[model samples]
Target: MSNPAISYAHITRVTDTLVTATEDALAAEEPLEIRLVHNGQQQSITVTMRSPGQDEELAAGFLFTEGIITRYPEIKTIHYNNNVATITLQPGITPALQPAQRNFLANASCGVCGKTDLDAIFAPVKKTITNIKVPAAILHDLPALLRGQQAVFDNTGGLHAAALFDTAGNLLHIREDIGRHNAVDKLIGAALKQELPFSQYGLLLSGRAGFELIQKAAVAGIPVIAAVGAPSSLAVKMAKEWNITLIGFLREGRFNIYHGQEKIAL
Candidate 1:
């Protein structure tokens, strides 16, 4: 048997008029409940459907991106059991479960599905990304580079991928999950664990760049984001406001720059 994130299953395939039974690899999706233990109290924060590997990173990234905790040191320990992640904060670090945090459902597809208000979902963070520029060639080549690194996507074609790359177009880290946001979270969480400075890197999203995705990248201090798909209006607006470069429709030879145009050398 493979890891929990992937499952081998028997499947029926139809080709023209012929039907055949075959075995296939599937990207597993399961419920992950995040819990916070603070001051001898336990609170189940939210439940999300995500691919199973890198559960710890998923838990930590979810907390950081939501402003639940700012730094890795704030966490005393993280433990997982049967889809539940228990996070114990360090002493003196009070857990403030805000209204927005309570409202988030952490759905696999979208990170902000059940939020009551736009402001609650993500209050803009002050601009921190600066002076990181990528050559047009490097920007154009990112999609193919990211495609080559999607190991799970190659098997199941059911997972989304996110990769962090430096200004020189070198891939730093990559993660794949059934959910788009989960993939980004895994990458961000890994970076946080390594304490990587995100200002000099760009994010490559395997799918459309949504507002939630942009928000996560901006929160990570990612200076640039390039996507193989389109960007939502709000994503562009947020990227522009945060001084993050937003690029979309990233094919082999071309891409569209919607914000921070100067970051992409023409």
Candidate 2:
């Protein structure tokens, strides 16, 4: 069976006066429209271009992380029309929650670019995570753990990844995508599907820790976020505001803690 999330391609390389053509594979991205229905009234909420598999989980995670719906019971059923690549969510029960201050429009390349406003970018959270500390040794070993589970990136080198790990440094879940934010969403979605409590876990990213990534982690009640790459200034600011532990440039047994250092056992 062919996987809709991946595609094969060919590429030509010329190096040192040698030209070679090789067969390769790449991740596929397609428009996925998420439609919401309440009391049988349908409303098209947002359209996102994402890797094709796990449509239902993606939608569930997106809604949950965006603060659109809190409990899984709020979502009745999710269906995808493969013909149009559109997903519809049936809210069987009336949603007592209001629409997000801003809607989301995501692409395969960037996740933070589609937001409508700053307030929406910095949505308020009700709970604050405290007194959770991870050993510095775990920070040093995280990249190796993340690298070992990246089966897709190992094969295609075309996808980013996000992983969740326990305090003991055991990898719980890892998700890959053409976009970094999508990867995080997939991980969050998987966690939500499993009904796992994420308050005690931390997030690890294969790429830079950006503002959107931090926001998503915070929404999911993930207390700590560690990235193998650098973080933007805004990402740091939001982490501080949200009381999230932000770590970046995590490599070579060293890392920088940008905020919420109380959670890091130095």
Candidate 3:
């Protein structure tokens, strides 16, 4: 298997008048251009800086969360050419081109730097998820579970991670990338490919849960989102409006629930 995520390199470390050569594995960051082809019309969606593996999943999840394709069946084929991913939608489906116009150059650290407005950014979730419940203890344990599976993060410590877990705290799938959004996209895209329902799962983020990440989870019908860092005000607002359970500051056996706290059991 080819690992495009990390590369071994020799580097010079200088500290306190001492210099030494050391070997390190640096996280690989590369540009991935996603193109949407619908009914013979081709549009360059966006070019994102991401870690190199799971390119197809990254494209699929991005298109889905961006409202370019509503259903998995809407995607007919995904082709890769160099750093570009071209997706062909099923005939007659109109692709949303607005997201493409927002920002084509997406950096790894920011998820929504390209958005035109707050209204356009919140893609409509199908419906408000209800009646699902996860134990608070299980929620607290999620970060560790997610961290344990972060093989890439262990090596490079530069990649972000997103993991999907069941109410019982079983980890379903996890993806790591240089970009936080890319990691979630990879996980969502893999689930879409396998036709898994999102309602039964909760998402765990390695970093702060931002508005864009919350919106993406909503678009996928995921009811719960747990983050190890603080959430933005916009993230809390969107999570409440979209009926998602958003938890942040997940550390030391404590967490803050911002929205949909009913879904979490004490």
Candidate 4:
């Protein structure tokens, strides 16, 4: 299926003495209303501006990662109407019943800006195994691997990507989006659909590691997350709390282990 959220366009640069035209890709950022329904009643919950494609996965992953839905069976169905997306829960499923101590609704550009309280942001992450270990060399080579897979970024230079790799440095899956968090969601959704053992693999992101990204990885049971850029303070803290290995500044055969260094071997 063609994703309506992204497209290619010719960008023209005009100057007094010269004119240049080049093809550029645009990332779509529009409001997606996520509604929840049970029985026959519906409630309009949150609206997020996210890149198109993988709307269903975005919804499912968002809810699951946010503690809205604990099990995959809790989500009955997810439907998207152009820009508006709705999620239907199975009978007796209620995310708000626990009094969602955090407000997750916010702009897609920054996932942690809209939370009203710190506890909401610091909610306990799901448990995961820690037996997996990856070579430090895999982190060194990931940037090139992710770059090779980003066809749209090569053309437009405007998309973010998340890739899953095994301990052997083999690429298992990849997803791209205008918003980094959305890209992670797409990747997770793809893995969930394939019944891939996510907790056994490492996650590589193309952008800086943030709190929301770490939270998503933790919820998905990903034991290790490596980023091509720096990690925020909150991201490091969350990773430590969730027992996840967080690595940053991954380039040129060297990386800094901000938390959980035992998972990466030299």
Candidate 5:
């Protein structure tokens, strides 16, 4: 079964001397409403804009990274319909919803999603096992590996991607979306579905590493995060605080290790 993640549109192309009408491929964007159900009660949790595929995985990943649900088994079943993902929790498992975070909502580029209270946005460090190591040469080849799997982005050039790789630099899984965080969440969700080992894999991002992305990786127990662009000050601070490896500007066999130098074998 396939949910279409790409849409087509007609457009006019204008150049220096020629004008032509053509068809263009666009990464599909749609709003997905996530809901929670337990003890016969259902409530709307958050609504986020995302591409049209992997709705269930996207919801599961969002809940885990947002500190709502810690384990995949906590989710009894995920029912997807009409762009809504409803997660039914297992018996006796109450969602860990904080008052300030309960009303969380975001757009496609929701790094912080209008949440400004650092106290509310930040969670305590997870004490992650940050000692995993990978060769520098292997790290240099990850971006191309990730780029080759971006099926939607290859067509639209409008989506961000996240991929999981083992210590030996083998590509594991990848997910793409218009939002960077959404991409990470989707990848994590897919991994969760298989009960994969999170701490043993590095996460590759198609764009800059943000604070929230680091928080998501930490929550998932992912040890290393490498991004194609730069990282924000808060992102670097959070990475170091969590002792997770963070690499930025990762292309052309060059990268800057903002934190967790020991995680990479130079």
Candidate 6:
């Protein structure tokens, strides 16, 4: 049995003047068409290129985060075949497919943005917690902590990760995918399955913070988002609007705070 998320490829390695032919592991990328079945009618909702594992979670997470369906019960059954994930909705439950989602397509690098449908995305719970007070020490340690758990990334040096951590800095869970957005969806899906509280945990992204990723976090009600890479301008704005903390360039013993100091002590 081989890792479904990894594909083997032949490559040539060059160092200084030496050349060696070798076989290398690559992050797999394949199309996953998410279809919706409701009211006795089925339709392809969106297509995303993603790693091959966790297709079921990816489907549910995509629907929830995309604001197509609210709770997990809206889905009657989820089945995957030939790389197509079909989500059969519970009878009498209608999908809230946004205007753009009907024609959405996402590649492994950037998931099709949901900004256009922001006003219609699922409304997250409104709540408050003031005891988290994360310190600089905890923030600084997150990169190494998350990096250590990236099993496939250790082998392929590819794939993005999304992890959840308690404010005390304890790792909750993590998901990896060729697409960062997909990784987030997978994590959220797992949390949904496990009935974990999203607002109580912090989210970490392995790559730069993009608007769509922020949108996904907001939809899930995640309170803070930290990324090892830079954040887009719109991402910062969204964080501000949501009152969520946004940290970027979060490595090398340093991180920049872009919004929300309520949860950070220093």
Model 6: lDDT of residue 197: 74
Clashing residue pairs, backbone N/CA/C < 3 A, model 4? none
On lDDT, the leading prediction is 3
Residue range 1-266, candidate 3, lDDT tens digits: 64889978899989999999999898999999998899888978788999998999999999988877878899999999899999999889998777536654889987776777766666757765567899998887888888888888888999899999898899999999999999999999999999898998889998998988998999899999999999999999888788899999999899999988889988
- Per residue, candidate 1 scores C-alpha lDDT tens digits across 1-266 of 56777888898999999999999998899999999988888888888899998999999988887778778888999999999999999988986467346555666897887677666788346587478779887777778888898888888889999999987889999999999998998999889988999888999999999998998887788889999999999999988888889999998688889988888888
TM-score of 2: 0.90
Clashing pairs in 5: none
Candidate 6: pairs in clash: none
Q: What is the lDDT ranking, best to worst?
A: 3, 5, 1, 6, 4, 2
TM-score of each: 0.95, 0.90, 0.94, 0.89, 0.95, 0.91
Provide the RMSD of all predictions against the true structure, rounded to 1 decimal.
1.6, 2.5, 1.7, 2.5, 1.7, 2.4
Write one digit per residue (lDDT tens) for candidate 4, span 1-266: 55566677788978897889977668767777777787778877567777777788877766766666666677788889977778888887767523233345567776555556666664447769768989887678888988998876775578889989999998898888788888887788778766688888999999899988998899889999999999999899888888999999887777889998899887
Q: What are the lDDT figures for the candidates, one per model?
A: 0.86, 0.79, 0.88, 0.80, 0.87, 0.85
Off by over 4 Å in 6: 113-132
Give the CA lDDT, 0 to 100, for residue 261 in model 3. 83
133 Cα displacement, candidate 2 (Å) = 2.1
Scanning candidate 6 in windows of ten residues, the lowest lDDT window is 121-130
lDDT of 2 at 256: 90
